[model samples]
Target chain A: MKMLGQKNNRDNREGLKGWLNPLRYGWERVSYWLQRLTGIFLLVYFVGHVFETSSLVGGRNAWDTMLEMTQTTWGHTFLIMVIGASTFHSANGIRLIFTHVGIGLGKPGRPDYPYYPSSLNTRQRSGIWIALILTAVAMLYGANVLLGGD
Target chain B: MRELDNMTVKSDKKAGCDPRDDSFDLKKTTLRVFRTNTAQGKDSHFDSLVVPVQRWTTVLDSLLYAKSYLDSSIGIRYSCRMASCGSCGMKINGIPRLACYTKISELEDPVVVCEPLPNFPVIRDLVTDFTQFFNHHKSINPYIQNLNYDKTEKIDEVSSSHSHRQSREEVDKYLQFSYCIKCGLCYSACPTVATDTKFPGPQALAQLYRYYADSRDAGKNRLNIVDDRHGLWRCHFAGSCSKVCPKGVDPALGIQLLRSYMLGISKDKRNV
Candidate 1:
């Protein structure tokens, strides 16, 4: 018994754009969005790295030419971004793995008023902050190696 | 302090002295309500209405005010005028929330925007269809099953004798999830449900976990119900479902816990 005018796929669905915006819901949402964007960024970088490595068959001159292109300020900045993305991705990914296993999150209790979700407790939120801090440190180190004092 | 409706009132104190002095500052505000008429061949658009307000005025109150004197045809569903019925759910100020639960002053914006909850079809102005949403909930087998039902001597005895009993500890396992009002706020807030139509949104998945974790439930095949491609596995833990849940049901946690059950991480099956 399907009702007419009740069909889905209407213009109402937010479609792909919904993935882009994290809103003010929680840090977990920002983690989700960042994880996705970083995954894509890593994937693109992975393919480019493979191509750069395969250029080794072209001998010393060709390899040096590739290195010369990548050894620029813009290239180093992009590498730093990759470092930050990967660091955040892996750190948050571990937290997600722990969460997915039903660990760390507190037990399901009675949902009293002004209810704070048991899953998003202090421990889990601290995990997010830890991941962010770890990413900042990794990105700084990467900047030092690529574009900074080094 | 003199009362001036649900708005801010000056208590003869200077403005800067009180950091909470947003009172009485906003007397009238504009409401950008979304409107869509399929019958009239009109596209979706926001209908702006400047309505007066008080401090305790909710988004629903503003809409009602506009409906009474401004326009008689604005389609908005509400019952109980409280957060109980879960009918007045809409995106207020770009966030999915219960209209009755959200106060206009809390928005902190001159123009409050009201749109139908996303991830569902718009039936009319600020009214989204819940057909598919309900169907997903139904597909997960939201109720408990009694293995004693088949061997029962009489159907009448099922209610009294066949009824399942539990201790306080057992009750707490699934009690938190039962508070869901099915407001569709979590469904709209979910990014997975935004694009994936097959994924059974958080409400349904959480309800599934509720039944699956119940000590009285004899349905051994509960985990396998959503063990398919479009099942609970699609949930990547975005957690907006729990964040936007008005009742604090934490559907995302329920989904994750259900996954643990499915993966055999918890060997203590209550029915076993």
Candidate 2:
């Protein structure tokens, strides 16, 4: 709280810049950062898609022009990114649901010296890898669809 | 490598079974310590001091050495050359860690960067204000109380009788979390605390679980304390709290487990 500190006290809160730096936080934070990023990107794409589809109100002429715009090389690449983001977001979301409910992390016990937290264990970290691999596979499939349909 | 022999004797490898920096080779290393004075309206700056180090010379040792010889104005907080006191927490090489616990040789870097712990207002130099951090811990009612007792009631008596005896399983539930020395390293390492000021950091949230899981603390009515938008719900299980914990107290595990109880998905509801 602002009242907690003296007026001269410097607000050293890491803020947005700290949130962007995921390298030191380990894989879970990286996944955390990526999930939020992809979610926002997808939301923007969703809004854009609504406007793109709404062009149909102008009839067949406007619809065909919209289709042509989306068929460009840059459009195809953007579509592939969308597929990748969605796949990663969904897969990681499922993993997070399980972990958030304490499903995958083993039971807490006595902490030995040189403690390694079980929540960040190999099993949980592997979930991130699985989501990434799934994202890659979906992106490749999307690339194939865009190329083949052309 | 300068005046001492820095050679590695190779042996059969299980995991890099070799002796590198095995001897306590005397070397001079620089510690780029963060310096600032909010009182005088000074901005954050680095004061790099070259200190003589051996294989086992800790960052704290180098810091104190620098303080005594290089710059008496350098502000540092330390107690117990060992890590038990939790007084010397700072960002060492971009990670919030206990300077006393971090050895120069183990870091394998000649220049050690020491800065104030992130997400906390730096009081002077590497020293940070822990008033809010401690307040967050206190907000969770970090002690056992009767189920009938409410927050308004005075919990002055910190009692532990045979009636409060816990089973082995009950002890195991929160024993690991009990190892927390309140170093504030985990709080500094938390990503949620970086931006969300109202959200109780991993340290406080972990203590919430520690008390909740304990069979003795039946203050289950207090569970909703962190149910707000800026509460435990804000924690997306970043797990940085566990990774940078100097004492191995897994705040992240406590958080997720607490979430299970809050979500009504945990196998046993008695932990409340």
Candidate 3:
């Protein structure tokens, strides 16, 4: 396939060589990788977090010990990563859902036909925004709980 | 037309007879019936028709018997009475099955429920407007895309691979999908088609893959058609279409193959 492309004359554009067109193909490639990586990472973390939470069934001390671990730097970092991944993943999912459902991108401030507030693309952007805001709040709350700042 | 008139007359005469007569042995049984006319709202209901069970009776027979005898307005659809012509597909007792193919004796009832095939706009009772279903089939350009070719040389002489003819597995894969009578049983059962009308239904997609996989179609131009948004990518591998196909055509599998083909994983033989 590479050989065929090289043999073909279509590959030889003189001017636009280095710069990538992010709109058409770049975002697609980035989103594809991000969605896959985030899904795998979040799935692993979800299982581990669920198992750690299950330790509370033993006693209050076990629960407190679990909480203490979450207060540490690694735990905090993991949570942040999870929030970022979840946001990206869910936003992309919303985008896909919209596209599949036949609700194309709609005008700004104009409600979608049959009264959906936003189009699929807009809904995806909103999902990402919501995830980011919630993540920021959660991080702040976690910090307050850990450092006794609140 | 003459055969149809004869059938109607025979059915009418039979319906006029009393099954409760001393000459006829009757056993009380339940018939779970779906109640929704096409013009009505989606708030459909089911009614059980308890009647005498008989051997060699089909689900459609039970329905016609009930409608002809017990009630006149019990809406349903049927034509030819045989499984051919692709009419009379509905959910018989939770599975998408042809009413003609189902036997009452095999059912676990006294109670049998019937509903219109899912995922298409219901026309009336058991009848659905198959216009959309067929329109999508046509949209895929189901015929082999023809282009400038040797008119003098018959197209029948196109070189076909020995593997294409000799391999039973390859033949069988296409054959499974071939059994679809276009009854819309799989269409009704498919969640993707139900949720998104634009996504070409499973049967069409399966057939699309069929032509693509054929060794005779060496031209790779067919691959360009389904690479867009509403094409192969819309399939989320729900696998419901396979589950509900009365013909056992695994359309989900075909769509997956299509996805692989679009991604260039499945080698373009012309490139070789």
Candidate 4:
């Protein structure tokens, strides 16, 4: 029994358009891309955060200067992006957890032509919507605080 | 009958006109078909042809029309001309779909971009080699295995007695999974399969869980087959497989159910 050796000849390459076009495949694919994108963003931000805080090793003056720069509009905007990414990542992560644990899915059903979405599909879609809504709410709150709106 | 008579009258008006005349007023849509000759190692190219778009015209119908009238050499594989046989799975426009099931008019775009299903070796224009797919499917031992039941007994004796039975609830557990037609669409739509060919795709893994969930099946140890590096752990739950499935067999959900089962959570308890 050859476990795994075959190589597909045709280029299955999903070009730039394939990655960019979220509406082509529907919400589930969009959610997958968004989850990956948010994960990368979070990872990069985490590394930057560690480095920024590590300025304490540069002594009191450097730490004070670094802290001062964070009070500016640019810093606030960057922080807002971080908050947005965090909100999306956290909410989507919960959705992923539920999916992996088989929470929303019911038993499989016969596929009708033209393809109707199952109850599980609908629930998972709603989960993406809920995550988007949470991200929006977080961005709004973050903006308000950072921009001195209230 | 009235609509048919009206259509006849409309065609009768253009009886003397050239068959290929654009003045016939037939609704036309462009079919952008992917063409290739792998035997000659010719570079793949898109051959776009304008096909008559009737109300009931499917993607398969358009391809067939193009093949018969426009280009005889264009290659495509189809049988049953319906969704049941699972022969005409392809990427229509961009999403994986059954060519026979997708109506040309239903597409949002006027130009229908037809390509062979991704994540498989293309033999020609629209025909893909399903050898790898079958190999992966066979690896999981898709058939039911009752280890406790002895098969060496006389067939007549087994027939005389009532065989092992299952309750309605027990049957329901694996019934949904039994609907798989092995179209390879779910595997084609999978991102994991595209990136990692070694991963036993959504189609096979779903079948694995299907048999495993059956009350009559004695293959409790079958979970070990999928628990390894290239098996169940590789699926990141992209959900593309489930999304593009023409049949409503949710392979992604099945894999998740299998995951929960492996984690020592009972199937009934995992749903909550």
Please list all clashing residue pairs in model 2, or write none if there are none.
none
Question: How do the residues B1-272 of candidate 2 rate in per-residue lDDT, one tens digit apiece?
Answer: 63332232323222343335254245899999999998888978898899998767899999999999999999989999788989999999999999999999999997999999988888899888888888788888888777544455445533322246668988999988888889999888887788877877899889988888888777756678888778888888888999999888899899999999888897564543
Tell me each candidate's TM-score.
0.90, 0.88, 0.55, 0.88
Task: List, residue by residue over A53-128, the lDDT tens digit for candidate 1.
Answer: 8999999999999999999999899999999999999999999998887878778878888978888888988988
Flag regions of model 3 displaced more than 4 Å. Answer: A1-150, B1-26, B38-44, B80-82, B148-173, B218-220, B269-272
lDDT of 4 by residue, B1-272 (tens): 99997777668656733345465555799999999988999999999899997666899999999999999998888899878889998899888889998998789678999999888788899998888898889888888897666688788877666376776667767776788888898888777777776778899999998988877777766888888878898887877787777777778878988888877666542131
Instruction: Indicate the residue-level lDDT of A123 in model 2.
Output: 88
Better of 2 and 3 by lDDT: 2
Between candidates 1 and 2, which one is better according to DockQ? Answer: 2
lDDT of 2 by residue, A1-150 (tens): 212232322278887888778888788989999998999999999999999999999999999999999989999999999999999999999999899888899889888887888899998999999999999999999899897776
Order of quality (DockQ): 2, 1, 4, 3
Report the C-alpha lDDT of model 4 over A30-143, residue by residue, as the tens digit.
Answer: 888888888999999899889889999999999899899888999999899899889998998998887786677666544565556453467888899999999999999999
A127 Cα displacement, candidate 2 (Å): 0.6
- List fnat per candidate, in order: 0.63, 0.71, 0.00, 0.42
Alpha carbon lDDT at A16, candidate 2: 80
Best by the TM-score measure: 1
Candidate 3 chain B worst ten-residue window by lDDT? B158-167
* Candidate 1 per-residue C-alpha lDDT over B1-272 given as tens digits, one digit per residue, 9 for 90 to 100: 33563235244334422335644354899999999976677888888899988777899999999999999899999987889889999999888999999998788999999999999888889988888888888777789886767673676777677766788888888888888888999999988888888777899999988888788888877777688777878888888888888898999888888887777776675521
CAPRI category for model 3:
incorrect
TM-score, candidate number 1: 0.90
1 or 3, greater by DockQ: 1
Q: How does chain A of candidate 2 score by TM-score against the true chain A?
A: 0.90
Model 3: TM-score, first chain: 0.55
For residue B17, give model 2's deviation from the true position in Å.
19
lDDT score for residue B172 of model 1: 86
